[model samples]
Target chain A: MTVTSLPHDAALSARHPGELGLRESATFDRATIADIQRAAATGVYDIRGWGAKRSVPHFDDLLFLGASMSRYPLEGYRERCDTDIVLGDRHASKPLHLQTPVTIAGMSFGALSANAKEALGRGASEVGTSTTTGDGGMTPEERGQSKHLVYQYLPSRYGMNPDDLRKADAIEIVLGQGAKPGGGGMLLGQKITERVAGMRTLPVGIDQRSASRHPDWTGPDDLEIKIGELREITDWKKPIYVKVGASRPYYDTALAVKSGADVIVVDGMQGGTAATQQVFIENVGIPTLAAIPQAVQALQELGVHRKVQLIVSGGIRTGADVAKAMALGADAVAIGTAALIALGDNDPRYAAEYAALGSAAGYYDDFQDGRDPAGISTQDPELSSRLDPVAGGRRIANYLRVLTMEAQTIARACGKSHLRNLEPEDLVALTIEAAAMARVPLAGTSWIPGAR
Target chain B: MVTLIGTETPAYVPAASGATATLVDLAESTVRDLNQALHEPHVQGEWTVTNSDGKHSIAVGIDAPVSVTIEGHVGYYAAGMHQKGDVIIRGNAGVGLAENIMSGTVHVTGDASQSAAATGHGGLVVIDGNAGARCGISMKGVDIVVGGSIGHMSAFMAQAGRLVVCGDAGDALGDSIYEARIYVKGTVASLGADCVEKPMGGEHLEELGQLLAAAGRTEQPSEFKRYGSARNLYHFHVDNSTAY
Candidate 1:
């Protein structure tokens, strides 16, 4: 005497195929099937924005060992926990002294709207951290709002001038980004506004292809001379930072240091991009959790570990992520995708709008389409006005404060007075994969899977 | 007493002309001393750089409307990013000579190495002797007049500038170039992708004549063959995938 009710339409029960007794294959998953169909439908490969969506070893796998019996914890609000950091004192006369170690990574004005750029500058400035310029070059809106601006010197040299070079707080020589290390970025004609075209010195509404390699120098030997040229251009005043995508972290870091870099910025594969092939994004480069130790080892071997500052970036989100990155030997951590989320990307309020674009709220990553509902990644004047720069700046400033406070809380619990003092000894990996990647011991065991 | 004229104290002597003369001896002081002085505000004079024996970045980033003459050969990036300043290299120049020059003139009396006047926004670059590979590569708005032959891949991706090569051009000239015009008096090995030999018209002749005259060359504009972008590879297409 079982009363089974099946009153709804077939479409209403369509969410799960498992109810039909169809076993889902892990190898050829639903997402993979859709990807194959997409390639078949369109002759072009899938181009989207965002970091690696695939699961891999990351920071969440590592847990902090808070003080219990052996060490005493600092009183939550009574004892002090500092988070200040100084970057790039190796060659430059002036170095950046940040209140918090967390800085904003490079995002171009063209990739983001003017309002978004202004908001990022305002937010980073409010928290006494540095903001960076990207490929398209510096804009007046961003330069005006940012307190400490680090200008990026790329291969394209778009909108690059002597006056702008001298105006920067620090100069970063960008070799590659984390999303696609050996590949260049593409800005579709839809996003290339008149202003962007003017800055880049390209045709209006033309798709611009950024060069992968530098036009002037050839190799590291030539890079050394190029560094000297930049130093001579600014009269050795601004700090020179060399940024590389995480691949051969050990060799790349050592070469950067050898090339006379005041700082090395290693970006992992989880780093976001304005536009890139989905395959390149998912396949290329290693993870942030794995890159830090290798970079640290290289710097330490060179006897200039702390001297040459290391700023790691890719998938930094929360305070725990920040603290964990620092404990792994990063002088500082940079945020990109998380910062955009804080500034209202993929917001639930724009769920309907995202659905119209064939995406959901949290699933929207078409930064290349230039039809961003959140007003952050679009150049449309009406959509750009949707995000009030002042309001967005405040939200991000609050988020940054929370991040800093949370890191401080973790540091206090770890019995460390400073965030940098939370070393590898205070961290343990929850899984053998993370243990091997982070080079830390697995949870209760004293054995690291990879360590000899 | 060995005196570092331009490094410690700038020796400004009133020449016969209205412009003052300042001598910078690289042997006496470092290149930093010379460049630092040139970067200072209100720098207006005729400067002479002596003993610049293959020094890199000697007299780079000069913004003043002064004239700098390097008496000897120099290494990489000699007179890079100079604006309003007229830099003259008396001997052979090494890699990246006058790289990213915004305005004014860079004249090399001897052979210049790779990437001469690369990414130059404006002004004129005159090379008297044969230039190495990638001459005027990615040149933007700068008029480069080479008196002798240029090496391979010359004028590749040259944008919005006039490159007048008085001698023969090397292989793959004007590869994937945009908006720029090239006039060569001698034989080209081959044209690169998206580059073709355009008919030399009246406007081309006059412009080439002016550039040649500016570079102080006697080659008639009629003898030169004009080349430019075929406007094929400006936009990407799957049909033209093999060219890239």
Candidate 2:
């Protein structure tokens, strides 16, 4: 086989079947050939796939108007767009006061390494937003690094303590996450090292199963009592948030309000997780676009729209996505996968290495195996060393600034001084799926079947 | 009986020995003042309370060896965290009665609500009328005797405790029962998971006699039937599916 290099701008010529070619029977599909080449190089098991393949509806089908209605547009750079968010206004003496509406969602310490969590916290702090701790108890490192911290109260009760509650700026009662709505978290046995096992109070080298229900309460009234207990423990200084996956959001939000929550976090389908069953991730809950309006409507019906802030999550990737979500009535947006991307999950510099593993850039979601070439997902000492926390945090901060800027630009173009002023009327859906799910009018039409 | 007029004084100030304190002045005190007075140390004496007016969490976290008598109804968590104290309510008590008690005596003349005597350790709780669901749940070392019917899932997950009920018990009476002695005088609605009726032996009768006496009941031990763990569902096994 003869090989020759091509010019920078040269076009390739078509070759005959017999010219510089082997037997046609020896040929293979591009994917199969790539797999064979990777196996020969790495000597690992057969190549397996990761992440979602089913085409779930997303925010791409929606569009935003730019100051065409009965409103005036703000100057691009001169006008101000406030992104402040206050959580837990119902009962907290000192609510969670954030400088920006954008915050980091919960990602467990066991799932991601300690350094990665710290980097996330630091980056969020640099951008004046809050960072949350996940199922693996509150670490002092995370608390000290973040300007504001939201501690998650999960079903597993891992690392839960009264001291941590007193120390946290806010407490989020996590009923469920969007990735696996009714399912519990399962840390595979291979990832359960001595430290991870010890932090979770489980036996080493065993798959840890988190219980679905809380040990203390059963229903809404009991939830009120539990909230009282937490308040008494914290001296009512911190705010309390109730987070639920987008399954029956109306009733869940109403119950949360009755249970005396100051904030509501509604996570929808397409949220990221360290590990979850593929079936649950795909089929459990509604899309984010469908969940936001329902939750906002619930709060509005209760006359507590701004009183109880609603933060939305799941599949948020761009600044345009953030603007679209706020227009639909989310007080703020939280990100996971995009944050990981900013921290170098699929950098093109590792293209050769990813190709060697039969994968490519932007397709590296196999985080549970501890072999991430980008150094963000792996627990291996050498691979993890490739990540510099300070540098990664700066990159994430830069990305966050860009997202915030883009959101503000859209808000200004919509004749809104604040991001919150980007109302639902500014949006129209391009597809029936989006139009029905988002409760908005279809493009080039005045029809909104669900509109009142 | 100490009278509290303002929040400056603790909610409950234990009386000195041989002193009788009338709680008539406590009628006008706020909940905050009452809590503060009750949390104060070194106030131990005989106390008589009148016109409780449905106050909740009264006499909570009291560890002194004092006797408190309430003339009217009480609200939730009454006598919670009582240690070495005796509290008597002439009227009904709300949920979580005698919650998390240790080495105390709580007597309710009227019915008690759900979770009565829940998670109490080393206490004697007596209810003159019926108790609600989850009665004596997660009890560690307490001895509870109810004169009327007890609700479902009573004595659930109890560890090292004794529950004696003179009237009928609701369904799943002893669900998830563990190492606890349950005595019932009337018909049971149904047995719970890992729970079954056990034959009353002489030693169990004696134990029942002691529990009944501690609960201030004059009933004979022979009138009651004993129940305990069936020991079938303690561990997971493939073939033992019938027990669970």
What TM-score, computed on C-alpha atoms, does each candidate reach? 0.95, 0.68
Off by over 4 Å in 1: A1-15, B1-20
Q: Which stretches of candidate 2 lie over 4 Å from their true place?
A: A1-53, A69-71, A348-361, A369-385, B1-244
> Across residues A217-243, which tens digit of lDDT does each residue of candidate 1 receive?
987889899999999999999999999
lDDT of 2 at A148: 90
Chain B, candidate 2: TM? Answer: 0.88
User: How is the predicted docking of candidate 1 categorized under the CAPRI scheme?
Assistant: medium
Model 1 TM-score, all chains together: 0.95
Tell me the tens digit of each residue's lDDT in model 2 across B1-244: 2354222222344433334454544466544344445445775555556567776666665666777777788877777756787888889988778876777799999999988887666679999999999898766677899999999988876655799999999999877666678999999999988788999999999999998887778889999999988755443334554544
> Least accurate stretch of 10 residues (summed lDDT) in model 2 chain A?
A44-53
Tens-place lDDT per residue, model 1, B1-244, is 2234643222333434455457778889788888998998998768888999999999888888988888899999999987998988889999999988889999999999999988888889999998999998877788899999998888877777899998999999998887789999999999889899999989999999999999999999999999999878776676776878
Q: Candidate 1's error at B198, in angstroms?
A: 2.5
Best by lDDT: 1
